[model samples]
Target chain A: MGRTTFHTDPVEALAGVADGDTVLVGGFGMAGMPVRLVDALIDVGAKGLTIVSNNAGNGETGLAALLKAGRVAKVICSFPRQADSYVFDGLYRAGEVELEVVPQGNLAERMRAAGAGIGAFYTPTGVGTLLAEGKEQRTIDGRDHVLEMPIRGDWALIAAQAADPMGNLVYRKTARNFGPVMATAAATTVVEVRETVDLGAMDPEAVVTPGIFVDRVVTS
Target chain B: MTAQQGLPLDVSGAAEHPEPLDRAGLAARVARDVPAYAYVNLGIGQPTTVADHLDPAQGVVLHTENGMLGMGRAAHDDEVDPDLINAGKVPVVEPPGASYFHHADSFAMMRGGHLDVCVLGAFQVSAAGDLANWHTGAPDAIPAVGGAMDLAIGAKQVFVMMSLFAKDGSPKIVPSLTYPATGLACVDRVFTDLGVFAVDHERGRVVLLEAYGTTAADLAERLTGA
Candidate 1:
């Protein structure tokens, strides 16, 4: 059993988390992501965090805040674009922020696996070369597979269009990236929704993440 | 490695069949200069051509930021495997013992300083080794920067390939840059249609390393001011 609490300040609720935590963020390139929460964490000076996002947003907008603050230690991402003020590049060259670049398709699957409670899965993603190094390789039906592990987070910070008292979430447009998976993967899921709705007010199928997977709900 | 026979220049006009050089020759030239066993990231466009000319017999290992190792050049139509593609989303072939990975983990490798060399295409590269290839804001332009930034900063050595001059005879390599920099002072070597040059860091000048048939003065004339 777990205890629940509420706060008017999202930062106060998030401040309970410690440093060096792995945080799964929901959003696609500047889409539906927890921008405010990310900024709050940066303002609080959280360091050594392993950040998982689709793409670090344009400079001064999304994950770039945390990146510019030099609080992120490692980044697990799909595409590393430069128009983002080259902040990622500067960190990379300085050996400050470690990076793991993944293919877009595999990134989705890895997040999906975490949400499914699978600890590890095998695929043909990386089998022959350096990616295969130190990884378990198996042949399935005359084909080779490279073993990959699911990525879960201590907390999943997500942004949603609406949420209820019980934490049912609905995303708007492109802001839904990896949100559902991240919601299920983390032990505690914290969300920042645009609108707070009464429980049972929303339709069933429209809710992407159920209240049970989510531990806390923060509305902005 | 064998020397490529130069293409005979057209005396009549600037247009000639095949432009006197095949893709293989270009690939070979790019591959010849890269040191063996160096972790290499091949950029999209012409830079991918190096994979074809790589003498794997020389022990060069190619890496795709998309989580592929032991990568080879673009596969022939008959050998094409749709599932296997480079970052550019073009079908490619994987050499023996090639491995795939979660895209995130692949980026980790690059950010971890494991890559030794990154070869990329460029719209312009200053004598100071600054690169700007992603966007010109031109109409019909596919606005993108892709992994060029990561590759530029992550790799130990940055190599650029491009024409010395734009179509309008405007020099792409200049004393200083006009466009946004991809990576500041990160480029180590450059290969152009005219020749190869390296950064003379302290002097802020480009040092001529090789010229196909052009002189250092002519190269400097185009790359630097009088």
Candidate 2:
């Protein structure tokens, strides 16, 4: 079992988060964004952060608030230009922030590969597009695939619906997006849940993320 | 790779067909064409409306890139749950048999070719079936692909839903893409407000299968996608 600690304070749980760290934020958009953790991160005053998420951010809150604070140095995301991604859009246009656009499936699979301890893998997702340029390509069984490497994270900030004392988690609906995979890929995985249940209360099969992958759990 | 050249609807026989469909009409048309019980994904924006037009009895399941399958229609009133949202960040309902998974597994379903059909909105589609929906190639435009590239290449059949002509009155179905490409030779069928088109990537041809409120000859004359 992983030594996962439970926290009541967001700032205290995110105390170790430092500047220039690569942070993987688990959310499809605002749905799974760990709002409390992000707020605490902003309070932690971490600078030059590299954020990885699906959407850049929505409106002037959560991830967008962090980006608006000019704390993010780069964003490695599948989609960065949503309707209210003004904070990121402005920074990108001014050359203040760096961006790496990956195909959505490739982004998810790369993180999955990192967590699964797999080396590089190939897929036909981005083949023949600008994204596959100058990359390794192989003809596997008459189909071409573009080689993509794993993307590891220094810390993962994810939100879930419920968590047990051992850090076993269950998410609600589509909010499960990147949480489970990100929890496995990061060196330190911290989660925010709406409530904490007793141990053994969660069914083993129903747990989206096991306790072994989580390092910290905070009830917010 | 060779697109089968044919028409399900007769455009040659009917001199007077129905008027060009409005947004809802176009969506209904696309929904009607989806194979029954097929696993489908509707892209964001106008393409999302296709879900509303689908008949619930058809058993067509919806897949969202965010990590859901068997997604229901948009959530409204008190049924809305922030956690139960779609790929577009809009609250959605979960129908019976709805399942959730991690991002990796969710996308694997798409890239693994389990999805039967995916309807997407495009900025332009080449005669060779190339998709240019992500970036406009403008110097100042921020490039954000989302799942456009993956869905374009991964789906068994990629159906493009958009107006045939852009707001500037330029045809969206072109001989070649003017914008940065999302995927090459990916689009299978294109359902536009004016007509239905099939791109034969092998022959680099775009065939006007059917037209509405206009004649196929007029579309053929206007479209440079041959």
Candidate 3:
């Protein structure tokens, strides 16, 4: 309805996030993670948060740091345990954190479904595995598929290589993982970028995520 | 030589028996089967070793679940790109013509059955071709089931890389799986330290295709306890 505002301060951009809210942090391992936004969230000290991401971060960088600060109450991710994910491992083993292990494909689809306004969908990804336990099942075209619900977040923290004045974003290389899907799946999407340019500076053809899905942009 | 040409068996010692191939040997055996121009996805663990054994001239393209196609071998300390890692979170190199996409699109490639073959590590594979490798359901087990389920059912052909027997000498290829199942009748072939098995899902039987250090008869006997 109005022009998007760019915040130079990460905390001011992420001030809308409250405690005990579902937050989606976009990244695959350490790449594409909103590090500055995460650090800002740490400064905000929002506790009892639910984090959804591809990983639990390798070390105390992004999601791992939030967990180490005793902010995260649960983590829903594809891979929660890595060689350097000692923070999650220790907290999980000590019964301090809850975890929901979703298959990578299903995780992406769930987020995409939420963004697309799809209520639910059936996928053959985890049909006969433990991930299918207690979920609805059906046979379609003589193949087994498990029903998965859409995943929506109260807020989404994303990282992009460049952002236009209107909040249109572009990501670099493999670092683009989960950024687009998450940009649309959250109630409020805040993006961290290296730089921002004029509205007409970016070619429409090169825009991966339109400004319609983004709420705020912060340059770090 | 191909794995079909079984290794020599020691006959001088009456009590000495043939030793199974080590992890590298098993990986080489799997790598030799990858056809040229094939788009392959190598799972974590032992299956990743297949990439190292593959001939660079084979033209085989590697795919990682995190969304990179045309992936190359594991990166060295100096070449490691922190942002470029495989599904295992291990650093990797991007081969020529490599492309990266969104996570959803990558899964679409896998679930849409665009890959020619996917090599995965397994705990147990039944004679009927059922695979169970994700979780053992042990209290101490973390139950991290990354992309194995998608790869197991989505790949055009699934090849499992594991040892013929567990550390306790119990056969991993059994008449029926004792652990939780990952996929039903999805496994096409299994490469083990001892031999390769072609699963006849229609007949619910396993056929020994090749062996490393033992005769087919001896391996069959060990498999069926004849």
Candidate 4:
């Protein structure tokens, strides 16, 4: 018989994540976050989570909800400016959250590297100043660059517009922002899709992420 | 006697002639307008080209969001140090007295509005002065909202540098922006390939200040569909 397992509800799926577990979330300013799953994660009350997202959503939504709940220990992203009312600044000022940022391009590449199973790559992105702190700096052919390690998550929470039961997914326009990369870079790739279909139902031309990387699916 | 015999003091060379406009000349013109002794942020690409033309005597302190202040222009090929980079992570030279700080501290300066001027490149500038530089609705493109959003609202004076029309001849300076905004009603002035215009904050209009060879009517017709 073909392998089979029960699909888990969002709350139960995320319940066992301990404090300080690294979580990579997919979205670009409220575009593709698993809003319902995020709410369930908040309900799970996991603290000290180091969240990786493109931008924190507004205070009442998604990742910002976790920030507001005082659950996120750190945020790693490209722009905190997208957060409503500058919550990142407030958290930083209050010592409630630590913040790290990569140039937007490098952030994407790092996620790609993580998914590709590469240990690290040298990029010109953060060679100088504080971004170089505690990282290996090397010079090649008379030019200097720092080695930034790839970021992998213990759990990847990704939102998709569509997902087939076998886990192939498709994202709407800007919703494709960070989903596909996070899907492969996490130990457990939990997918939340607006519509879920049976295996082999989605057209191969439309699939953004292949099914093999996904470990769970939640139909929003 | 020998000097006079060899060359009769070429008066033509001594006489000034109007040099044709070029990228460097345009950059110099932009630099000439930036007030001295101001904290300024320069964006990547075309806007970064403006630094090449900044007069050495001008006391403009450049800030890079990755935590360096007093960044100089691109270094000579022989002087390039890949270790010194700007916010865009391009190799750059640190000017004298350049300081480094934590990323959060750097953002604090921006959020606290310590920057006096920010020069940016834009894909679109709405007639109401909204900026949209990050996402352009391209399928192959990744929408990276860099420091544009912070610098858009953080600086007291926001100056945009871009071509008036995109390569396809569509007006980039528009009556209303279609892309997602970096900041709402935050832009102050625009310096474009066509001309310079001031944002009329109260009236929600773009007041033409100077256009190289075009008129306000012509610009209005192309940009506003007026």
Candidate 5:
């Protein structure tokens, strides 16, 4: 079989993921959340996962359900508390899971760094806040900057609007948030698309994630 | 605090105590100041309503921190799309020239000084323009900073919208922030129901630009101890 497979079932697409893998799950709130892939990963029952995402979980679905199942050991995200993020909030307060809070921009940039092979970079975000504690600080022309390291992922689970058979992906509207960057940061990026388009159907210039970044895609 | 007493109080246009600006009134005031051909980001809660007051001809583009620019009005009934939403998670539509990018690129636009202005709701802003809005530092509270830190320091001009006082009548504008800080010396202006104050971080002062129900001298004296 070719390296990139378009699976009919997301479970099969996620079959190789093992326990304790650092997974980067895309989405802000429910938008662009790979629910099928998350559900499959849930059924796969891999535990101690380190999930990097925007929100920890919402309501009783997607990442929340994954958190509810006790599969995640640590959550490295920008924002974890929300009106319906009870699952993660509960688990976090109970001291059952570790939490690492990062500024939203830093969260995205760190992953972009991992993908682009940047060793480390100084960022103005979170320079003096509690989040910047213990990090090296530099004054560049009198402006404060903090050293931030790259965040790599073993698996990136993302959602897309459409995908071509060769694996180039495009997402709908604001749902494209971290999907493009996450795809490049992971060793294996798994995507779930609503539909698969023929190769020529997708505009070459419009492809948000090139085929090289994608490892698997399941039509959900 | 040193410049408070000597500051000139403009009493030329005074009603002694004109009625304070309501939500719609405050939004209108902030909208008037949005420069033409500017890219703006409105924070969640009170700041979001400022979008409604914006005029299209002014070439003011709305930037939703979630990953959109040139954001349009809210989606109703048939127009709602789960994938198309604003920073507040409310369904929205894209304008004709709307653009979308990934989170990194989106945030880069903010931190890189590409945005013209960003309106936000604050818990407190000191005379030195120190911002304290992200967290209360309450032990039991679940902290969620979201994009507050990024937007606070990123925008070219940071305007804060809030009631003049807390629910208990305590002033939200203080000499120093007791609440945890979001960013240091980042806020440029404070738009309140009572008045508008400009923060001069260099001189460490809060100057009254306009007053609603209060006069400059009275608010200034209060600012010293408030």
Candidate 6:
């Protein structure tokens, strides 16, 4: 019945992440990225990590910075080759990094399934594409679907606009893209919020992620 | 200027080599065929241009897989909101009554057959209506499929926008695709710079519905030939 504690330092909030850990980062491109936590992970120098996100991040920011630092061994993302994802491109070409390119819808569902404690689910997203290669396929109700396993992370770093002392979070605009789903799919969820208020400050209905799923909160 | 005005204008020579429609022209032609009040998704590259040519009165809703519905046209440099972007990661404005949801929900709208039409760019489209656009699988190419596969299969009607020929003069519409398939029997129509084609999946043939600067017979020959 104890409440979740907030961390004043980003490094301390991300202390649980270690080398070879799988980290789920919440964002769509640059939006909703937990900048401070990402910076903290870079500072901590966790190596050979598996990073999951939507994009590789535009320019040298967020996940790109992590990849540029050579801390990531692999990246699982939908849009891994954006106009500005030169970091991933360079590493991938040099055989220094690996990439698992999942379809956007499948990516979101896999993460959701992880949080929901589901083993796996069938999706029609990548049926005939390269993404469907080697994956199990089944015909359901006269249609084809590919079986995708749940995607879980050792730690999840997410961003939010506001949070209460109990760790309930509310995100801003499109910034909320992967935050809620990533929060559930991780063993430990650390949220970076702009502001922290009292327990009841966030309206119960407005909270997208309940406090029970979060383990730490950091003000960025 | 006076000498040019008095010339015969080389009209016969001009007719010998008709120019294909430009990118915007191709998009506008595709826009003309989009049904009114339809909910549509536009894939990146040439297909995104359809948003610019759509009639404002048509009430077509643009859905972005990154969690936005009722998205507006591309935003100007000054109006760019970094956080507000389409699935392609390009900045865009949102029209009134626009709603944002979780990424999963936005995808559900796409995969659950709620979209009326999806316009996409293809590397190659088979005569049997199969689509292949995600990757060429070249040695140097970075494979990033994104949402093209989902939109290809889930949308009620899949419309493709692409050039009729590759830069090497290879026909993009062929009897069978050389590239990997994105979806099977998914495409209903294709709008290329040369013409608009209706794919007859059952017969494994593509019928030229309209031509811009080329004749149907010439286009068909090109498509049917090696």
Q: Which candidate wins on DockQ?
A: 2
Q: Which ten residues in a row have the lowest lDDT in candidate 2 chain B?
A: B1-10
The lDDT leader among the candidates is: 5
Please identify model 1 stretches exceeding 4 Å from their true place.
Answer: A1-6, B1-226
lDDT of 5 by residue, A54-127 (tens): 99999898999999999999999988988889999999989998999888998999999999999999978886
Give the RMSD in angstroms, all C-alphas superposed, for model 1.
Answer: 15.0
Error of 2 at B99 (Å): 1.3
Global local distance difference test of model 1? 0.67
| lDDT at residue A163 of model 5 (Cα atoms) | 91
Total clashes in model 6, counting residue pairs 3 or more apart in sequence or in different chains: 0
Q: How far in Å is the alpha carbon of A143 misplaced in model 2? A: 2.2
Model 2, residue A13: C-alpha shift (Å): 1.6
lDDT of 1 by residue, A1-220 (tens): 2243445577876866678999888765555667778887777777899988767556776688788888889988765664554777677768788877654445656777888877887765434323346889898877566677888888888877787776777765334546776788887788888887776798987777777777766766
Docking class of 2: high
The lDDT, on a scale of 0 to 1, for candidate 4 is: 0.70
Pairs with backbone N, CA or C atoms under 3 Å apart (clashes), candidate 5: none
Candidate 2 C-alpha error for residue A17, in Å: 2.1
Q: Please, what are the lDDT tens digits per residue for candidate 4 over residues B1-226?
A: 2211221111111212234235666677678788988888888777788877777688888887655688766667877654456665456676678875433346556645798888988888876788878667564332356666667766889998888788988777666666666666778987776666778778776766665555555555565553
TM-score: model 2 vs. ground truth: 0.94
Stronger candidate by TM-score (3 vs 6): 6
**Candidate 6's TM-score:** 0.92
C-alpha lDDT of all candidate models, in order: 0.67, 0.87, 0.85, 0.70, 0.88, 0.84
RMSD of each: 15.0, 3.6, 5.3, 19.3, 2.7, 7.1
Order of models, best TM-score first? 5, 2, 6, 3, 4, 1
State how far residue B40 of model 3 sits from its true place (Å): 0.9
Cα-based lDDT at residue B58, candidate 4 = 80
Instruction: Mark the regions of model 3 whose C-alpha exceeds 4 Å error after superposition.
Output: B1-20, B76-79
Model 6 residue B208 lDDT score:
74
In model 6, which runs have C-alpha deviations exceeding 4 angstroms? B1-19
How do the residues B35-80 of candidate 3 rate in per-residue lDDT, one tens digit apiece?
9889999988878889888887998988888879988777897998
Error of 1 at B167 (Å): 12
lDDT by residue for model 2 (A75-106), tens: 99999988788988988989999999998888
Q: Model 5 segments beyond 4 Å from truth?
A: B1-17
